[model samples]
Target: MEDGGQAQRAWASNPPTAFIFLITVFAFFLPILIYFPPFPPFRRDALLETHVQVGIQHPSESGLRKSTQKHNAGRSVPVTAEGTARNNAKDGVEETPKTSTDGGRIRSLWIYPIKSCRGIELRQSRVLPTGLEFDRLYMFAQLRSPFPAPSSPSADGSGPVEHTWHFITQRQFPLLATVQVDLFVPKGEADSDKAASGAFLLVRFPWKERGLRGVLESAAAKLSRGWRAQPEKEFVLPVAFPVGSSSSRSPSPVPPGSGQESDAEEGEDVEIEDRRPRGYTHEKVTIWRDTVSALNMEAELPRELRLYLGVSNRLGLFRVDPARLREVRRCAPTPAEAGYQPVAGFQDAYPLHLLNLKSVRDFDAKIDKDKDLQELDPRRFRANIIVDNNDYSSPYDEETWKKIRFTSEPGNRKESNGSNDKKLVPSTFHVSCRTVRCKMPNVDQDSGYRHPVQPDKALRKFREVDEGAKRMGCLGMQVTPLFTNPGLPEGRKSWVEVGMSVEVLERGHHVYILQ
Candidate 1:
C-alpha cells in the first residue's frame, strides 16, 4: 500500500512522464483507428430502400394460375381477347393495369451487335420476331489449333475442349467489355453512293503491348495520370444487309497470315486500313448446345486486335448466317402449338430478354452488407428491354406475366386503313420462361473487371424458385413474339420504342423447359 501511494505521488509530480505514457497508448492504436473506423465513410443506402418486405409468394397468391373455376382449374383455355375480357369481368377479376395510366414504360433498349461485347443503347428499335434487329448478330470465336491442346492449368477446370470453333464470352475473356462498337446507318442521298450504300460499324479498344514501357503506360492509364497515355485504337468495317440473304457477297478464300505480322511488342499504333483485304469466309461456330454456320470476318481484322484480345492461337469474328437459321429449341412450344419454331441469331436462348428495374433494386438490397459491394448496375444483366415497373409493379412480378403487349403513344401509333389494321395493333409477345442466370453477369461492362463472387452469389440465397431448374437463379423473363405468320409483309412490321406502355395481357404459371 505504501509503495503504490509513493508511485501515484511520483507520477502526478512528473507531468512529462504522464504525457509520454498517453502518447504511447495513442501511437499503438493509431493504425487500427485509421484502418477500421467506427462508421463507414461512404453509404449507398441513402437513395435506395430495401424491398425485402414480402417473401416469395405462394403460387395461388402469385395470380399466375389461369383460373380457380373447378372445370378450368388445371387446364388452359384458349379464348379470344373479347372472350377473355368478358370472362374476367364475369369472374369479378380486374385486368392488369395499363402502363399509360400507371406510368410504367420502357426505360431503355440495348442492342448488342457482337455477343458479349459492348452494347448500344437506343431510343427506338425495330422489333422483329427474333427480337431487336442486329442484336447478337455477331460473335467472337477461338480458331482451333492443328495440334491437340494440353490439359488446362486453370484451377476451376473450365477450359473448353471437344469443339473446333467455340464462342467466346466475358466468362472466358472479361476484357471483351472494354471493346466498343458504333453503328452508322446511311440515309437519303448518302445511300445512293456506292461507298456509303451500307451501314458502317466502328470498333475501338485500348492498345495492348508488353514490356516495361507498355506496363508503365497501362499503369498510368489505370491511374488516370495521362502520362504517356496511348489513344484508343479503332477499326471500321462496312455492314451490308441483304434483302433476304445472309450476306451481301458469297464466301471467299481467306489466306492464312494475310496481313504483315503486327509490331505490337514495341507499342506501335498501326493504322486500321493498312492491315487487310476485305472478305468473309463461311465457318461453323458453336454457341452453347447449338452449332450454326456463321460468316467469318477475319480478313477485315488487324493482327494487333487479336493480340490485344489475348488470343494466342487464332481468333475469328463470326456473323450470323441467315440461310442457316438457328431456331429457338429451348422453352419453345411445339410446331403444332405455335405453327412454327421461332428463330434467333446468336441469342443464348430466347429472342427477347426483359428485365424489371424494381427487381434489380430489390436484388441490390439483398447483397451482403459485410462484403461492402458496390451498387449493382443494370448493365450487368444485359437485357434487351429495360422496363421501369414504377409503382404499378413489384419485384419479381414479371414471373406471373404470361403475355405482354407494348402500345405506343397516340402520336407514335400508326393509323391502319384496311385488312392490315389488325397487324398495326400493339405488339404482343408470349412470355416463354425464366432466364437461367450465369456468372457472366458478374463482369463489369464499363471496366472489364469481374468480381470474384457477387450478385450471383447473393442471388443464390433466395432466387432459385423456378420449378424446372431450381438449381439455378433466375433474373429476367425470356419472351417470343406471338405471330400467326412466320413471314410477315412490310406493312405488318412492329416497332418498340422507349416510353412505350406495357400491359400484361395474360397471366399463368410458366412451365420452364430447358433446352
Candidate 2:
C-alpha cells in the first residue's frame, strides 16, 4: 500500500513537470504565433472602402483625378473672365477682395532652373503641369557607366546596358551650388520663337578665377554670335570626341612627336550645323530608380563648361524630356489610372515643394538660439512656394494641410454653390507627402561651403521621422497642382501669382510628430 501511494505521488509530481514543459514549449513558439497569426486574409479593397468612409480619399483619386480625366478627354473647361483678369494682375499686388481675410497670402515664389543650384526668387511665376515654369528644367548628370555593346551582356542578364546617367545633386557635389544659372527667356517672344531660340541658360561661377570666366564668356559669345547669324539652324560645339576619330573640319593639329596637343586638338573642335528641323535630341537617362528620357544638350554646350565641370568621363546638360513626363512616385495614383500623371521636371520627387515661413523661423530659433548663426536662410530648403504663417501659432502647420485652394481675385469670383464648377474652381494642390530631407541642406546656398555640424545635426535631433524602411528629416510638403484652368488653351498664360489667398480645403487625419 505504501509503494502504491509513493507511485501515485510520483505520478502527481510528473503531471506538474509535464505542465511546466508545455509552458516552456508555448513560450518558445509565442513569437511565431504573434508574428504569423492565423488571421483572415487582408482585403485592400475593403480597407480602401473604409478609408473612403472616413473621408480619407485614395491619394490617386485626389483633386487632380477628375481634372486630368477631363483634360485627357479633350474637354475644355472655360476659365472665368475674372480668373483670367486675376491671373493677368500685376506682380506684388493682391487682386482679391480685402474682405476675404480668412486665408493666407502667397508670401514668395522661387524657381530653381538647375537641380541643386541656387534658386531665383520671383514676384510672380507661371505654373505648369510639371512645376513652376523653368523649375528644375536642367540637371547636371554624370556618366554612371559606359554604354555596353550588344555582344557584351550584363552579369544580371539585363542584356546590353547602354550608358547610364545619374543626377548629381548638392548631396554629392556641393560645388554645384556655386555655379550660378540664369535662364533668359526673351520678353514678348512667342512660344515657338522661344523654343527655337532655346532659352539661353547662362551659368557662371563668379567666385572662380577670372580666366575661367573669360573662357566661358568667350565661348558663350561665340555660340550666341553663331545663333544670331543663323537663327534657323541649331549649332553645336563639340568639346570632346573619341580618340583617333578625325573631324571633317578640324582645328590646327600638333606635329607628330610634339608631345603636347592644343586644347582644340585634344578635344577636336567640331561645330555641327544641324539643319534638320529644330527639336530637342532626347536620350534615355536614369534619375534615382526611374529611367526616363531627357533632352541631351551636350552638343549645344560650350567646351569651357565641360572643362569647368570635369568631363573626363562625360558631362552633359540634360533637360527633362517634356514628351516623357516623369510621374510623381509614392502616394500618387498610377499614370494609366490617373489619365494624366502629375509630372515633375527633374525634381527629386513631386512637382511643387511648399514651406511655411513659420516652420523655418521655428527651426532658426532652435539652431540660432544665441543668434550667432547668420539667420538660417530659408533658401536652404529650396522650396518652390514659401507661405507666410504669422497667423498660425505652431510651426510646420502646413504639413497638416491635405489640400489647399488658392482663391482668385474678387473680380474672378462667380456666384456658384458647386465647388466642382469650372468657373469657381480655385487653384488647388493636393499635399502628396512630407518631403524627406537629406544632407544637401548642410551646404550653404550662396557659397556652396558645407558645414560639418549644422541643419543636419539639428534636424536629426528634432525633425527625424521614420519613413517606412528609412528615417529622414521632414521640412516641407510635396504638392501636386490640380488643374484649375482646364479651359485655358495650351501655351496660354495661366499662373498663380504672389498675394493670392490660400485656403485649406482639407486637413490630414494624423498629426505627424517628429521624433
User: Which tens-of-lDDT digit does each residue in 325-367 have in candidate 1?
Assistant: 6878667655555556677888988888998766776677788
Worst 10 residues of 1 by lDDT: 46-55
| Alpha-carbon lDDT of model 2 | 0.57
TM per prediction: 0.65, 0.59
lDDT of 2 by residue, 1-515 (tens): 99999987987879988789899999998666545543322222222321211111243532223323443486433334543343233323232333332335666677887787767666455567787777887787777665444555665667766567777788877777777654443233312223213233445543222686555544443344343321111122112211122232332222222233244443355333232222346677777777787766666455555555444657766866555678675754355433356777788778899987657766776773322346677778888887764343245656556667766565533222223233233566767667777888788886777776678778777776434315557788888776634344363224565555777665553223332
Candidate 2 residue 290 Cα shift, in angstroms, is 0.9
lDDT of candidate 1 vs native? Answer: 0.64
User: How many residue pairs clash in each candidate at the backbone level?
Assistant: 0, 0
On a 0 to 1 TM-score scale, where does candidate 2 land against the true structure? 0.59
The whole-model lDDT of each prediction reads 0.64, 0.57
